[model samples]
Target: MKGRFHEKAPDDIQVFFPNPESEDPMKDEVMWVTVIAHDAASGAFLGILLNAPRHLKDVQEGDNVVFHLPPDAPLPVAVGMGGERLGWPVTAADSLTETVVRGVRHYRQGRFGHNPPGIQACVGTLGHVLEPSPQDAPADLRALGHFVLARCLAEQYETERAIHHFEEVLRLTPEDEYARMGLLAELSVMVHTSPDELKSGTELDWQERYLKQMATALERIKNPHSLELLGVIFSEEEIKNAAESNPERERKLRRIGAGAFRYKVR
Candidate 1:
């Protein structure tokens, strides 16, 4: 059977399976497979199924088979606060978000030391995901990698670095609403907690200005996904507070939403 995932296998990359064999992956019980070997020349892969296939009747958990990735599959699942994850992690960004959550939980419980080391390790892990290397990184993965790194850096008070990463996401995928909203959330936190942290670095022109960056992001957003729906949860005050009170920009935001938007608010 052809695997219904668009991705061609790369070393250390996992294979995707669409459960229920449906066109709408959102409604299906999907599975992921760990590829043992992939032949780029032949478009074939040797892999062990990581989990039982809910729809692919011939496959069972731990089954080894030779195959080629087929059709188009979903992106690496979104990872963060309230982000949905499926099966085992297929990317480093998935792992980092879990680590960040654990660190936050521990720090809240009087384990103050959990904060620093966790942040440091996350930084190292994320830095490895980037750099002058060639890996089969999708735009979604690249944006998420940068987005998560930006959050970690922001928490560590590395505002400039955080801005650089957020801007990188916008640079990579201008229409990414999560990163856009993330900038808003980060700006809210900075405004309420550490306004002094907002300053310049040797990066994009919009690096130091959260509102400006967000304005640019709003203008450039070409692709909005269901994830943008998460922005609806943000209170008016939270959304209003994130950006400076700019009526023109707010009008533009509303206008954008009017045309095509799953990414309203925040």
Candidate 2:
């Protein structure tokens, strides 16, 4: 059975679901929970899955154990569930977003303050799943998912799939410069690299197609940084001509080129 949705997993780690819920419906309802494990090193995603609880014969969806509080804080501490501090860690007022972001920042920065696998995983999984709706997904999560999926696809050497993911990110966040840049970057690779480069007789050379598509994407992007980079690939004369031919594109490409120069220098 599928598990709940998760926003963002930890950085530099992969999560694994080795102990999935038991299939015996008679023992317990199918309790399932997606545990976000870290990479021990950089703490990126290991994977996610349902974890079976101790002493619970049957597992219902979204049912599992949680050992709240840092492991080294001291022995005999109480644990909390669903935001209630029934046991330890000295409850304090803070938004769930703040809490999760804090932990993520810590792990990513490698400034973790004595976070054991238990505490890190506990808070990491907090608010892990956004409301079951497209609108409910947090912007940062959406962004991260796009980035992660792009990286994964790229790793598999699927340039077009990776570019599509980045393009989706641009669609979701028109104002996001990084996402825009990423989309253009990946698209450039896809169009510039011909299938012949990869192997002919299978498909049209993607690199060549990507080169052709770059012009259209550059025209649409607002960020100047991306525009300038595209110009590097497209040539200034080509860009100038395109801008002259289409006023709207001319304005957008100018801004993109200007913005690209502004940031690309750094």
Model 2 misplacement above 4 A? 1-136, 148-158, 194-213, 236-266
How large an RMSD does model 2 have?
16.2
Tens digits of lDDT, candidate 2, 73-186: 331111232344221123332343444333333333222223344334433343242212134556555554454445444434556665666666666776666655555555
C-alpha TM-score for every candidate: 0.37, 0.34
Give the number of the best model, judged by lDDT.
1
- What would you estimate as the lDDT of candidate 1? 0.48
Residue-by-residue lDDT tens digits, candidate 1, 20-52: 335676644445655555567966666545566
Top candidate by TM-score: 1
Error of 2 at 69 (Å): 30
User: Lowest-scoring 10 consecutive residues by lDDT in candidate 1?
Assistant: 257-266
TM-score of candidate 2 versus the correct structure, residues matched by position: 0.34
| Clash number for each model | 0, 44
Candidate 1 residues lying further than 4 Å off, grouped into runs, are: 1-116, 131-136, 185-208, 216-266
